[model samples]
Target: MDWDDLRIFLAVARAESLSGAGRGLKLDAATVGRRIARLEETLGAKLFVKSPQGYALSEAGDRLLPHAERAEQAFAGAEEELSGIAGQLSGQLRIGAPDGCANYLLPQVCARISDANPGLEIQVVALPRVFNLSKREADMAIAVSRPTAGRLTVQKLTDYHLSLAAHRDYLSKSPSIGTKADLRAHRMIGYIPDMIFDKELDYFAETEAEVVGLASNSASVQMHMIQAGAGIGIVHDFAIPFAPGVVRVLADEVRLERSFWLIRHADDRRSERLTRFAEALGQGLRDEVVRLEREAAQSGLAPP
Candidate 1:
């Protein structure tokens, strides 16, 4: 089958609706349907099973997916290579990361990317989780989740240590809190139930956290609430400790741990600009991790 047809197939498989794929490609739904139908007719097999809800890939379609994905990666690499020969890094490099990493961790490295590459513009998509690299949703991502696929690359970007904290003024009014059990008496500002944290905090159930307050999706907001002395709270050293008036109420032996992995489509690993960008970004991460740790330690926070 033609490469363009494979692309159409991939989009339909992903979107799960001929109409949805048409919207993405700016083609008419009838045209999309005809193309997919033509493709399946040529191949002599059903690629999709349609229901009232949407399209789902048939077994034949599933078998074709990985090869189609790899072909797309090759095409992306070919395009990037030709562009790279023009001698400067210029064009959008779509990078995805969680909002937490974008806010607290990636700034320095992002700045460095801008400084080093000059013309290389980055579309920093703040997704809650890793983008599907194999699907070309993002060229690269700084992911909190460990690399599950054996073909990917992973790194330990850094660790952030949290502290039991409140406003110093609040502590002055209230007595100093000692031991984990004292947490039950204090109001704790907690994140919304759906927050995509770097790590799980189910251990908090074992702690004395009263968790009497709730805030929306942002950790930054939760931090402000805690600093307002609304309640005692746990804030990440990376995400929130830079703010004023928030003081460590107690040092902790337990800490949440997470690491960022920079994953790319393995098929494109040999491409020049993609290689350079990944390497530069990885170096930036290494330097940033050290810088963050120094700041956290100076602030008297423990390390995870």
Candidate 2:
């Protein structure tokens, strides 16, 4: 019945383990367990069933979820309202994104946003897999493809381009790559085929390239391999500016277009703080992508 108890319950449900929930809540696992026990006693219902895998929500817990989420949203709204400075973003905002965008784009973009709103604390969770916004893994997520399901709001953040690239030294020493077939003659660096988390990241899907001699699930790692003259690979145009030694190879023949989408919980539309932050974040991303791509083009590492 208490909001604080419901808050703890929500965290436990999301994390599915006392230790995990404790870490997020900054409380000890024993303390969290005691709180859950207390909450269950108050409700006279068993909210979770413990197993080796972790806590699985009981029927009562599942039933309590929607109400708890609504309460969480209400608390967040109240905090935003009490903060009083509607224009200034304050508090934690976590963004989950693919390693490519997080590595190439977010640092500077987030820095600028933080500079403007000194009280804002931003965390970027960069991983190769899709983020679960419903579980609160991130306050928001930037995805390569639009999601078709869930209580979510999606916005196209920006359209970005990618091209086959290699270090200048590698290109100079390697045979001419006048066509896609020529790619077979060279060592290729790319995402591990089985590890590619998204279809859009399968840059070589349509190509006849034999195999990835060097592979990583992380885009930044692949870019480093290319920069080290390991082999040619698909690199984001917005990322080229960061690797001065890298140059586009077969750019005209191997260009790819992909867009980043800003995804958020549908309920967030009711919060002005998140709405303003989303707008600012989207605009910053668009601008940074343009600037970085232009710089890459001027450096002759990407198409103008």
Candidate 3:
């Protein structure tokens, strides 16, 4: 019944532990536990079932989830309407993105957004996996592939290219790689096969390399490995500007194209602040990708 109690409930439900919820809510674990107990008593139903894994939603909790989420969104919309102006954004906005975009793309894009709206605080959570929008893990997420399921809205951000790349020094010292077949003789750098979270990220599927000699789930790490002359790997064209030592290998022979999708909670459509921010974010990414890719091509590190 109380909005504050519902807020706590939502936090606990997302975190799945009292201490975790407390950390987010800036409350002590004991106080959070007491609040949850009081809320449960007021509702006259059990909201969670405790286990070693942490608190999980009960049937009553599941039924309450949607209503609580709607309340949260409504409150957020009201706050944004009152606190924000028509053209400028304020308050915190968090984005979840893959490490590649986070490392090579978002820094400049987000910086421009922040510069235009000095009151806004942006947090970029770089992870290798898909973000859970239902749990409010991030306000929005930039995904390598379009997700097939969830209460979400997906927009195509941009199509980017990847090509086989390696350190210029490594190529001079290693066996000549005239064709994809020659890759068999050299060590490869890429994602761990089993840890490839999205089918779109299977950049090595078309390659003849039998195994990844050096692997990482993070694209930035894989790029660093290539820069360190570890071995050849597929690198984003937009990222080429950041790793000056890395150069394209088999640029004409091997090129991979992938897209980034902007995903947001479907209900966020009602929030004017988020809608404006999303527009700015989309444009910034498009421009940044183009600028970076052009720089890479100009440097003779990627295809023009």
Candidate 4:
């Protein structure tokens, strides 16, 4: 019934765990658990179903979610109005994206935003899975595909390039890869087929290459493995330039292009901070893609 208790419930619902919600609320796990319990007692209904995986919203919780979100938006609007009077942005803005973008791109974009709004706190979650807006996993997300359904807003950020790449040493010592057929003979590094969260991430499906022998769910790890000369794998065109000794293989013969989509929950769309951050973030990503494409063009690589 209390606003504070509802806030805790929202956090817990979003995070799916005691520690994660506690971290966001800056409260200990015990306090969060106690508050949730008190809220449940007041309503005389179970709000969450706890399991080994995490907390899931119960039937009652689902019924309460929309109303609670409306209250949250009301608070956010009032806060934004006040912050506007002060001429600054404040509070946390969490952006989630695939590891490839998160590791290679978002840090720079976030830094610029932070410099402009010192009062704002930017939280980036470099996830391998699709971001769930319905669960409020992230305030915004840079995704490969737009959501087909949900109370969500989607925008096309930009299209970027990816291609098969490997370390020079690995290419030299390994079998020749003059054509796509040769990829079958080489050890390929990529996301585990079963663990791929999005269909867009199923890179192997686009090629004749068999199941990857060296696999991981983390893009960072897959990139590192390629750089370490483990095997040939697909990599972002923008990121390969930074990895010494790594070079694009069959640049023309094997090229993959994917677009990034920006997504946010409709409920939070009115928040000034979220709106400003989305604009800045999208523009920043577009600028970065342009720069990378220019660099790739100069190198006579894939058409960026």
**Using lDDT as the measure, what is the rank order of every candidate, best first?**
3, 2, 4, 1
**Tens digit of lDDT per residue, candidate 3, span 78-152?**
888788765679999999999999999999999999999999999999999999998889999999999999999
Clash pairs (backbone) in predicted model 3: none
Provide TM-scores for the models.
Answer: 0.80, 0.96, 0.96, 0.86
Model 2 misplacement above 4 A = 301-304
Better structure of 2 and 4 per lDDT = 2
Summing lDDT over every window of 10 consecutive residues in candidate 4, give the lowest-scoring window. Answer: 295-304
Every model: Cα RMSD to truth: 3.8, 1.8, 1.8, 3.2
Residue 27, candidate 3: Cα error in Å is 1.0
Better-scoring candidate (TM-score), 1 or 4: 4
Candidate 1 lDDT over residue span 86-161, tens digit each: 4667677888887666777677787878886677888788865557775567777777667677556565555545
Global lDDT scores for all candidate models: 0.70, 0.91, 0.91, 0.84
Decoy 4 TM-score against native = 0.86
Candidate 2 residue-wise lDDT, 123-223, digit = tens:
99999999998879999999999999999999999999998889888887888877889889999999888898889898887566898999999999999
Per-candidate clashes come to: 0, 0, 0, 0
Clashing pairs in 1: none
Query: Looking at candidate 1, what is the lDDT of residue 163?
Result: 56
